[model samples]
Target: MTAGNVVLGLCSYTHDSAAALLVDNVLVGFAEEERLTGDKHTAAFPERAVNWLLDTAGVDPHSVGLVAYNFDGRRYLDALAATEMYAGRDTTRDRAQPRAESFRKVHDRFGSRMADLRDRFRRARVVPVLHHRAHGLYSFASSSYDAAAVLVVDSLGEVQTTTLGSGRRLAGGGCRTTIVEDIADPASLGYAYGAVTEHLGWRRGDEEGTVMALAALGDPTRFRALLREAIPITDGGFSLDPRWFPLRVLAHDYPRVSAGFIAATCPARDPSAQVEAVHADLAAALQERTEQVMVHLARRVRSVTGLRLLCLGGGVAANCVAVGKIVEAGIFDEVHVPPAAGDSGTAIGAALAASLDNTRHLATGVTGRCYLGPAYPRLVLAENPRPGLTAHRPAAPAKHVAMKLAEGHTVGVFSGNLEAGPRALGNRSILASPLLPDVVERLNDTVKFREPFRPFAPVVLASAMADYFTLPQPAPYMSIASGVTDLTRERIPAIVHVNGTARVQTVTADANPFLTEVLTEFAALTGHPVLINTSLNVKGKPICGTPDMALDCLTESGLDALMLEGWWVSKC
Candidate 1:
């Protein structure tokens, strides 16, 4: 495709802002704004990201064919107007700033693009793809299944709580996916999940992962009565009882319930140091119930469509724990989850959807690397190494860094094309001995500064994965949670989560030989085939971009050493 025909999908201003550039239906670059902005879940226009892509790819903005925004401001504006009418606000004065504010934000973002465009380009071509279509396309276009049942779940999108689609491969190699069912209004699983997340002491979107993790600690059997009362599953789907959970105007920050259930279900924890067994049990039950419901939904999709393969997208797919259960249920023969599985991935989906009609085509397998962002050459760091940091040439060679890692000192491996997704894989990751039991606690306390219960993933030499975990297939994106045997866990306690499962990313020598050789060599030295692989970043920021960034993270975090390209540095 000529540069002009390329469609750049931008999801800006909304949460998890991102940009995905598509050329002739092939995704070339996709990145989230948070990574560039250095803010966790940063919701802003990804100007730096856009500029970086144009610079890296050497493409001009004017050459872009179409810019696809993932949302329709008109729809949001309609919602805002209706909200004001519902609230009986003074339309002239009180609501003026809000609407003006919205216009200003949108104008400030898109207006620049409008001016930058060639004078000949039509304004109508700058399109706004529907919200659900973006979610559907993200799952369908990135999936390997040609004709599979598709489920897109998020808190809310274009009045759609959940959608069911069928994706099929087209004759000539592309694919066509159609929405078979759209559950709008009340029957939204995403909203039901969000309601509970809000009920817990966490922000709905930001804290859903916490709730998912916390659920394992508690049993929700006692709360089943209350849960059913709160979110009832009907023949259609799930619904939030308007009394307990009310849908407020779009302007409201968090979805509001009548403050009644908050007092009833949520009580202050005792000041004394005591863990609430009941609370833990309640959380456990909720998680179980959620898993059951998701299975039920998956089964419904299978029975309704009779398609065994499934592709999942949206925020709920981020719940790897629930996803593991869904996979283990054996309802679907195979499942694929997109790397960015959230709003950030929508740009890829929407642009792809716009390019195809309803025809069956299997998507290429998930992109394993998260090196989609801009990369800095080693020379950039060599020109100016920060004071006291000696820039030695790559130790031994690119291939020999793996041998050094096998020899036992912790080695930070940053090489090759960086990964294109959220996972660090081997290209942009920190590699250390997983044999150390304290590795997990150390990484969390000294580097991650997050909950110790949070587990690190293991990137094993792919040839050795079958012996460690009963993996159904190669999990390139770290999407599947697999069980590590007691024998394996004893050897590598660092990567195992509390649930006794690890989000494993297996590597093949053919895929990443330099890193794989390192793992193979490490195994020869220690008899363990896995390495402790985490993103090369500080606790709050996205993964590092330059050698300097990686070096700073390594030095500040008190990590032992770094192996960049060929140069190896040990902490002085």
Candidate 2:
């Protein structure tokens, strides 16, 4: 491989399809196909994303010295062959065509899809890195520690769903990686969690967050009798009791009718006031139990590696509540979590792992900004303002608008650079007073059109996070959860989730100057450094892409004001 060579990392042909480009070991641009394609959890080839990355970086694919894909086709093929053999040729015959075709298509594309580029440059190499190792790389390499214990948890990364390892910066600026443990087949926390998510009538990969949200509203204790018997932890990992589930259902079928039908037999009540006490207890128990399992795993890693720092990645990292528990336990002095902990980040991981010639790795500070997505120039906004809306350039300036917010005005902010992750950094967010209970309802009904149970997060001045949350570290990416003090929770009830935990994105003056300025103005006026921040989008849509998208939201929703690049518009 070439030193400081450009590499293309693509996680297409599977879930969370995305494209990332690494220029000289630095992540220049990364984006999921779903956002641009407008399909949630898009699993198709990331053609647009790949093209965008090359175009944005002003580099030809031919310039890429290496192309890193997230999985080993040969290993995956072996796993499939084993599954088919075990199922018997007669039974496998019914299921093999589509499965075989999927693998074939990916293989064919990987070999020849970028032929023109290879011809142009001809020096680039295609490298197939194992999926879990890439995941471990993404977490450990991006971490704050020079040496740390790394743990990756996911539904399944190829044949392995979970891996435990140790990673250290080499003495002379290289990286040392070791995999101490691996669990394959039937031993997956993700599968366990996914099973329950399916049992609850959610859309599996897409709706797991919803289950996590809903769990906060119910009693976990009420479901322990049922769940404990269903999912059990063992030396290998976690397992499911056949009484509560059926393994014969294809792994690809998520929350299917068959699964639900099986669940109905082992009854649970629909969410209701009469069942609130039981439901809340059950939710709490499942959350508690999941945390318990994670803690056990963390303890095992610490025991084996004796590392004081820990790094986490994968779909399970999305569980902030569980993450908070791990942090509070004090097992690790420090923990680092990637903002894009899910499959979308695999592209970055794959590229970095494949490009490791000397093994010296450094965590690239969170990409310069989330504004990696397409932008709308002034023309996009001028030509269209949405129906029933008027546009204005502020005469008094954004500082003046900040003054109004400080004085308790609710504002919807949309300006320069849309964020890439699930969290809405300041660019595409609805800013509001955390003190109002009615604000949550209003935002939900008018702007979000989302489940009322969904809660907003607070973007607070980084320096002040400790004053309100039991945070051990500054959470720049809102990657983990922190407890809200009773006093603060009472004051900013709108931002607290049902479980009294908040996924906060701490704003530093250096990282987000404009947002910090607005919050500073608000803090000066109201004596609080936090504002309610929720994604700027309507239900079932991705975050707003343009100023017009922002304006459309403001006029269509019941919001009172819209804040944009140094300007705020209000209805006279």
Return the TM-score for candidate 2, rounded to 2 decimals. Answer: 0.86
Question: After TM-score superposition, what is the CA distance of residue 166 in candidate 1 from its true location, in Å?
Answer: 1.2
- Which has the greatest lDDT? 2
TM-score of each: 0.84, 0.86
lDDT of 2: 0.70
Quote model 1's TM-score. Answer: 0.84
Q: Compose the digit string of candidate 1's lDDT tens values, residues 1-572.
A: 36545667777666777777755455677777766656767777777777776666667776677777776544443334344442454323333445445544554554554444324234325666777788877776666566888887777675566777777776778666777776664355666666666655556666566566666666677677776676666564566665556553345553455566666566533323244565555556666666766666677677767898888887777777777777888888988887777788886666665554321332233344344656555543452355555556753454455565555455676776556556677877877777765777778787766554567888888888987876677776787778887767666666777677888887887777777777777777778788888888866567665566677777778566677765666655
